[model samples]
Every structure is written in structure tokens, then in C-alpha cells.
Target: MANIVIDRIRKSFGTFEALKEVSLTINDGEFVSLLGPSGCGKTTLLRIIAGLETSTSGDVLIGGKSVIGLPPKERGLAMVFQNYAVFPHMTVYENVAFGLRMQKADDARVKAQVEKAAGLLHIEQYLDRYPNKLSGGQRQRVAVARALAVEPKVLLMDEPLSNLDALLRLEMRAELKTVLQSAGTTTIYVTHDQTEAMGLSDRIAVMHNGVVEQVGTPVDVYNYPATRFVGGFIGNPPMNFIKVPVTNGQVAAGSEPLTAPEETGNEVILGLRGEAVQLAPLPLGLEMKVRVAEPMGSHLLLTGSIHDQPVRVVLPSSETVRSGDVIGLKLDPNRITWLSPESGKSFPAATA
Candidate 1:
């Protein structure tokens, strides 16, 4: 029952608001990622929960107990920071046993806990090795091992893998999920990388402008974003947004018109991901004037325009396309996400 409930959490730095009345609930044993660009307050929110920073308002509860005024050490949670916090003077075993030892745990108890944690992190073989003898990834595992040795009610990680190289980060991402899932601890991870968030989290809380823009499973967030900001932020190249006119709950797409579920305004934004575009026969689909065709290894990323709006479409690399060429593009109307012009809120099941 190590669920966390964040109630109207707000934080301000004198004149600036870092968090704006944000509320979210993380279920027991569920992994939730606080995802956003830099300065969006993801790390601040995590620090508040960890009792490292004080919120200007709101209460934080862990396993139903209010933890607002509790010190980090009393919060029954453990944290792994962006940098590996392993002690150079200590071996892997000693580092993992630090927390247990600090609790005045006996020799046998410490050994058992350290060994268990090391095994879970796959660092049991390196128990006798010091930090200097370990690679970056191995050192990170030691930090995670130390946190897990204490068996926290909640595990908070702040970009723990960001410092690793790209290949190592990819490898650790897969391994981290396995280790955490086996631990089954309620975890809150803060990261700016969408791939990391989508890959590691059971649910993602996408933040923007100091507030959570949307919270959903990876598939839901990717395929069906809740806000214009979400659709724009979640993808690698981001979503392609075309401002279109809405008349009588209808908007023109390509060969057909798309109907809006609700009346937003005379103008609405239509969003499409790169995966949603396909090649179509000429005159039957919309024609895009190609600006540049980038070789994306598996496909050609055609940077072009449709109806005078900037568009990027993915085409099969086998297709012949050049900077001056025009490609026939067909889009699935059902996959289009409609966003409001007034509030930028996306309609329900907008992706469908």
C-alpha cells in the first residue's frame, strides 16, 4: 500500500512559480514518470515528495500517511540521483550496506540485505570491487543497489541514467525496468527524455508550464495525447500540427473532410505523427511539395508542405523523391488528433 497522493502541490521561487497547483496519484507498485523539458518542475515535484524541498502549498501522502513535514530519512523512501553517489573509498558491498549499517543493523542482517540488493542489480560478482574499478553503468547499479538494500516503500530516481553514454543508457534502460519490476516498489522517475519516460514508466505524467498536461499509459499518451503540448512534445520529431479552419464541426484534411467531436472554434489544430502518413496514388490524395528528403536509414523523412502548411512525411526509402519533387500523401482521418483553438485541450479519443 505504498501509493503516493500529491494534493495541490505548489512551489514558488519568490516571484516565479515552479509548480502550479499540481495533483497526481501514483498507485502502489506502479512506475510513474514525471516527464517534461528542463525547468518544467519535474525534479522539483520529486524533491517535494522526497522531503528535500518544501512546497509553498499542498500535502504529500505516502501509503496514506501525510509526509509533508517529515524529513527525507523518515519518509520511508530511497532516492537515486543523476550522478552515481557511490563512495570511492568503499567496495560495492560496503556501499550497498551503507544504509543498513546506518540503521544500526547487525553484521548478518547487513550482509544479507546487501547481497540481496546486489543480486537484484546484478552486481553480486563485483561486491569486492571499489568504484574506481567499476564502469559508469556498474557504479550506477551500486547506487541503485544501495537504495534497494533499505527496501524503501517508495523509490525515487532523478534521471539516474542520464550521465551514461547513449549505448549504455539504452542497455541500462532495459535492465532497470527488469530490476524495478521484480522489486515491485512504488517508483517515481523524473526524466526529460520521452524515450526514457515511455520505455520505463507504467504511466507517464507529461508536464508543461509547471503543471501536468496529461497522465496516461505510454500507448495512450503517444497515440492519444490530452493536450496540444503533449502531442507536440511526446514524439521524437514531435507531432506535425497544421492549423485548419473548422466550419460547422468540420475540417478539411485531404480528399475528405474531418468532423470534430465538439465545437472548439472556427480554427482548430490537426496533429499527425510520422507513422500516420502513407504514400497514395496521385490526385487521389494530398500532394506535398518536397523541401528535403533525408535518408533515415529505413525510410526517407520528406520535409515538405501541404496546403501551404509545413509538413513532414515518412516515405519508403525505395521511393524516389528529391527536394523539388511532389509526393502523394494519404492520411488516415481516424488517426488525426483534433485540438482546441481556445484552450488547446484535445477532444476525447481525438486520435481515433
Candidate 2:
């Protein structure tokens, strides 16, 4: 395993800039994920690190050596793509051993390595089966085994779980963590799924518009987001942002005064997660008219309009709330997030 560093990398496709001055340091034996929306340049940055796509400027270093002019093979990195790029005619053992065979490894060594990798991935029983005969998850494991057989210095994965079913993806998430930890390989993963990033990464780099918005541990990013974009992008059901005026320890929406910590201005966004908002018996909190309620097994998703503004809240399944009924909802001040209206930057509440 080797440490990877990207220094001021820039990439462009014709007139469009895909990555701009991107820089990050991935430590040796650490699993880091680059996460963002579809067009946020996460994949582009990963490709640059893998030496598959050359950056227009700046340098990429593997184990403290510059690989700017090195080809992908010379960079000593293994890449697992979104699609399981296995040969249909070849058995799983052949696919896993192909890399070693290309390097002219002896047959005995290649056979041992392939068997070890397949066993590690728990696909040893299917080693003789062709790709067309295996299931999607099995094929994915074969892809991973193939990448591991070469024993590259760094492992790069570009949404490798995108093709699996939901249950299979969950299973593979745990399997991947175990496999990588046992191998002690430094890995960089790129994905648009926030859940995957939060669950799998040691550190997450949240990217936007060809630039990194924030980098932090999963809990830090979720609890104390550095930017409004990061806060909005990393949560399920997203965050509920309400425009409120704050003045002298008080916050209000239109004429209704709400409770919040003291602040400097009269214009700020009050951000709250759906799980933070609760339905109350009293009519003292924010007065919202429910538009719809979706029962999601364990929780109820309440979609409503607060003074003509759309808002969503997640309530317990036992709470009985109907559509078109006016309800009182409370926002936990400790759970509230504050964002600057002009700069779109997050700030903590004075008491929070």
C-alpha cells in the first residue's frame, strides 16, 4: 500500500472544465471516498489519480513519487469499474489470473494467487464458472478478485456497487470493508451515493462543480457541515431549509415568532433534518398544513406547507396525522443548523 497525493490538478474536456485545482491527500492503508452529485467531478478526479485520464496541469504522486508522465500500468494502481468487466468465455479463475499471466508469472504462482484471492472474496466455489453463468454479485466479486490478484499499491473503485441489487449492495458493502481491511490496501472510491460514502469511508471528500466543498469524517460532515451544499447533500430525505428572520435571540417566519438561539442578523436560513421536526399536541409551534403523509413502515413522512412554503417532516408511525389538517410542529434547537443567506455557509447556533 502507498499514500496518494493530488496537487492542484486541473482537467478540461474541450471548453468545459471538469476539474479545477483539485487537491487531496489520501493516506496509506486508508479508505477515502470522493462523493458528490452526478456532474460534480468526483469520477473525473478519481480517473486523474488512476492515471487513466491525464490532468491538464499539476501532479499526481504515489508513495511520494510524481506520476504525472507515467502510464496507467506504471502507476501501479488497480481499478474496479462500475460494470463487471469480465470475459464471458473465461472462467472466474482465468479472469482473476489474467493480470499475473500478463506479467509472465509462473503457472504455479498464478494458480495460488488466484485461489487465494477467490477464497478471500468467498467466490472460490465458482472459480470454474464463466461470467455468463454467475450471478451479478458473483461477477462483481470476480471483478474485485481480479483487481486484487495483481496486488497493486493503490485500489481505485468507480461506483463498483452501482450494478448490484439493493440487498446485494448492502452485503457487498460489509464484504468490501472486511476484504480491504484484511489486505491493508490504500483505496480511493468514487460514488454519488451518500449512504455508501458515509458507511464505507474513513474520510469523505464532498465535491461540487469541479471543486471540493468539504472533507471530513462521516459524522463530522453529517453533524457539522462546513457548507450549505454539504449539509443538503449528505442526508437522506435531504434537510429542511426554512427562511426565517433572526434578531436578538429570536427568530420568526412572517409574523409567527419561533424559538432559536441569539444571532446577529434578521435574515438567515433555519436548517433542520426531517427527523428533527416532530408533531406536537399543542398549537404553539410552527403552524403547518399537512399536504400528504407517506407511511414508510417504521416512520411516517409528512409533507406539508408552512405559510405557503413546502416542508417535510418524519414522524413516528404511531402518530396519526391526516392530509389538509393544520398541525403544530416543533424544531429541536439543539438539532437546528444555521446558514448565511448571502454566502450559503453554515454556522453554529450560539447555544448549540
Candidate 3:
């Protein structure tokens, strides 16, 4: 296992700055994920660590030594690409043994290592099958097995589960975590899927426009987002940003005023999660006309407008409500977040 370090890495594709002084470190045996939307430079950062892409400036170190000048093969890393780059003509066993063969290991060593890796990935049963005969998840397992066969110092995965179906992807997520932990490999995963990053990673680096916005554990980034962009990006249904006129510590949503602990700016955006909007009633309430109600198996998602501004709320599936139904919602001040309109940074809000 190896600890990977990236120090102020910058990359430019002509005039387009692909990475703006990005820096992060993956500790030994730690599972870290680089997560962001497309063109955010998450993949570019991953490739830089793998030596597949050169950075315009900065340093990369593996196991406490600089690898900026090293070739990919000499970097002591194994990468699993989005496409599951397994040779279609080779059997699963042959595919897994290919790396060992390239390293000129003896037959006994290759067979032992292949057996071990296949067992780790639970793909031992399909050892004799060709890649074309394997399912997408199984093919992914073969690719993982091949990477593991080399016992790389660091493991890099680039959306390794993207090709799988929904259920298969979910299953593979659990399996991938277990396999990586058992092997004790330091991993850096890149994905655009927020759920995958939250579920699989010990820590996540949230990237935006080639810059890392925040790096934190799942709970840290989810609960106390450092920036409005993170709060908006990390959640499903996303957090609602309400344009309210602020005076002192209060926001006039409508008749009911939303107040924070201390005064923010003259015009501050209120960031509220859909789940945090209470549907019943409060002494001070904001009326919303329901535009849509979606039953999401466990929860009912309601999209509505408050004073002509859009709002979304999540209710219990047991609650029955329909479109055009006007309901009074109590915005939970404890869960309310005050954001700067210009800078998009969050500030504390008061809860009575």
C-alpha cells in the first residue's frame, strides 16, 4: 500500500485551465474519491496521478517519493478504467495472469496470484470463461482482478461501475468496497455520481470547474457544507435556494419571517433541504401552492411555489396531498442555512 500526495497541481489545455492548483492526498489504505460533474477535472486529476496526463505545474508523490518524472509503469499503480479494459480473447484466468506474465513470474507464482485475486473478487468460478461471455459486473470483476494481480501500490478507478445496470452497479459498489478493504490498497476513485461517492468513499473531494471545492467525509460535506455550490451539488433534489429580502437577522419569505442567529447581508439566499420543510403548520408559516407531488417509494416529494418562487419539500409517503393544494410549511430554522448571494458561502442561522 502507498500514500499518494498531490501538491498544488495545475493543468492547462491551451488557454483552458483544466486544474486550478488542485491539491489532495490519499493516505495509505484509505479509500478516497474525487467527485464532481463532467468537465470538472476530477478525471484529469486522476489521470495526472496515474501519469497518463501531465500537469502544467505541481508535484505528485507516491509512498513519500516524488513520481513527477516517472512513467506510468514505473509509478507502482494499477488503474481500472471506465470501460473495463480486459482482453476479450483471453479467458478470465489468462486475463488475471497477464500482468504476472508480463513481469516474468514463474508459472507457479502466476497461478497462485491469479487464484488469490480471483478469489478476492469472487470471480473464481468464471476462470475459464472469455470476457464476451461474462456479464458487465463480472467483466468488471475480471478487470479488478487483473489490476490486483500486479499488487500495485495504489489503485485508481475511473467510474469503474458506470457500464453496469442500476442494480448491478449497486451490488458492485458493495463488492468493490469489500474487495478493496480486504486487499488493503490505497484507492482514488473518480465519479460523477454523488450517491456512489458518498456510499463508497471514506472521504470525498468535491471538484468544480477544475478546482476542488471541498474535501470532507460524507457526513461533514452533507451536513455542514462549506459553500453553497457544495450544498446545492451534494444532495438529491438539491437544496432549495430562496431569494428573500433580509433586514437585520430576518428574511421576509412572505407574511412569516425567517430569522437567523445573527444578521447576514441585505440580500441573503436561504438554503433549505426538501426534507427540512415541515408540512403541517407553525405559528409562523409560509403558504405554498403544490405544483407537483411525486411518490418516491419511501417519501413523497412535493414541488411547489412560495410567493411565486419555487420550493420543494419531501414528506412521508403516508401523507396524501395533490397539486393545487395550498399547504402551510414551517421552514425549520435549525436546518436553515443562510448563504451569501455573491460569494455563495453559508452562515449560521438561529433556531427557536
Best by TM-score: 1
User: Sort by lDDT, best first: what order?
Assistant: 1, 3, 2
lDDT of 2 at 333: 67
lDDT of each: 0.89, 0.86, 0.87
lDDT of 1: 0.89
What stretches of model 1 exceed 4 Å from their correct place? 350-352
Screening candidate 1 with a backbone cut-off below 3 angstroms (N, C-alpha, C), the clashing residue pairs are: none
Output the better candidate (1/3) by lDDT: 1
Which 10 consecutive positions of candidate 3 have the poorest summed lDDT? 277-286
Model 2: which ten-residue window has the lowest total lDDT? 253-262
- 1 or 3, greater by TM-score: 1
Residue 228, candidate 2: how far off, in angstroms? 2.7
When 2 and 3 are scored with TM-score, the better candidate is 3
lDDT of each residue in 1-352, candidate 3, tens digit only? 5898899999999999999999898899999999999999999999999999999999999999999979999999999999998999899999999988988999999999999999999999999999999888899999999999999989999999988999999999999988888889999999999999999999999999999998999977786676888888898888888877777777765456777546466777778888886666533467778999888889999998776889788988988888878887877766777777888877644442
Which parts of model 2 are misplaced by more than 4 Å? 252-264, 348-352
lDDT of 2 by residue, 1-352 (tens): 5899889999999999989999999999989999999999999888888877889999999999999888888888888989988889899899999889988999999999999999999999998888999999999999999999999899999999999999999999999999999988999999999999999999999999999988889988886677889988989777777777667657853334656544447777777788886776545677778999888889998898776778788889988888877888877767778888878877765454
What is candidate 1's CA lDDT for residue 199?
A: 98
